[model samples]
Target: MLLADGIHAVITDRHGGISAEPYTSRNLGGAVGDDFDAVLRNRHDTAVELGVDPARVVMMRQVHGRDVRFVTEPFGDDPPPLDAIYTTEPGLALNVLVADCAPVLLADPVARVVGAAHSGRPGTQLGVVPALVEAMATRGAEPYQMVALIGPAACGLCYEVPAEMREDVARVVPEAWATTRQGTPAVDIRAAIEAQLHKANITDIRHDARCTIETPDLFSYRRDSRTGRFGGFIWLDGG
Candidate 1:
């Protein structure tokens, strides 16, 4: 279990489970064209490893947008199209899949709530982090009391975007240009996420110092073109 000071979570790597190559071992997403059985087994293994009930661990068909799903109760049904999820309920594990896109986990120790955000360019533009924070606040969470951790993702040095894309990012965040490298602009997704967290008054933020595109151990969608998804899961434990 990858335990934070106040929450239970794990940022799963591409090893240790059963999936064929490309997705070669530990692919948790069944909808990513991985075999259903393999995906199920992989998820079960991850849940057990993280100490969450396999039944309470929930994953949605992520649409890469800003839709935030508010979880007030536990259920086995497919969640609505959303890129962010939050819950104050114990034993409810929220899972988000990512390869190069950043997976962000937020927890409020005082409020006893946890949230997960999927921050691709689209999800960032749509303000998924703020949306998750807002949802948590509705469940009696205070933004300033939260601690956020951004898991492994593609770093700014490796992400080269077209000029037009850079301008698009500037519309929301003007400093996005500073994260660029050379003429080809690249956004520091982790930095951008931290900025958003700051804007929401979330002070205690952490980031894994790993870049998927540059690291062989990590699965990168952009690097391989076809790759398996990695998981970032968080849940509140019932004491």
Candidate 2:
């Protein structure tokens, strides 16, 4: 969906590229064992489709922790280890790669600040989503004034986990606690993240609603051990 003038944000599905096999056509993840050149070409082509320069894309190593960083410039291919990337500077887009994890895109049109985040069960339990909101707040983005887009992820019904792990995450985010389709304990990472954003007063949120594990059009690391990752991007226009 179009966020606003000068703000470009979108979530890519696992299609429309040149990778083969498990990666299929569209694979934005570089470290997922896809051919380096194919991955690079797919990334560049995706950026070109978005009218952005491939070199200017800002991404993270994404350690599934609470580390959030601000971007004033590009960091090339070797991005730092962090879960969230925010930018007030125009022309620099933030990209978040995900397989079963939630990819969050933030935009505050009034403040001209945008951010992208990758959050899984660990990140949800560790308050990474709130940290990204706080980072945006420091840059003049009020929580209520911003809109967040939660990309596709493994749903609660499909994301079964250990009983202890579910209990651990549920302690912090009760909204995430759930039972899988087969009556197994599970954690809905996206639901937990949305709850966090709501607690921070960020109520304007959208969701892609596609489950990675259930959708063949999207890649799922849990479903395919060698799967490639799709991505979501957020940016402001320099012009």
- Tens digits of per-residue lDDT for model 1, 96-200: 999999999999888898999899877887788888899889888898788888999888887888878877886786545534355567877777788889999
TM-score of each: 0.93, 0.97
Which candidate leads the pack in lDDT?
2
Write down the worst ten-residue block by lDDT for model 2: 1-10
Query: What local distance difference test score does each model get?
Result: 0.82, 0.90
Model 2: runs farther than 4 Å from truth?
none
**lDDT of candidate 2 over 37-78, digit per residue (tens):** 998899999999998877788878989999999888777768
Query: Which residue pairs in model 2 clash with each other?
Result: none
RMSD of each: 1.8, 1.0
Residue 91's lDDT within candidate 1 is 81
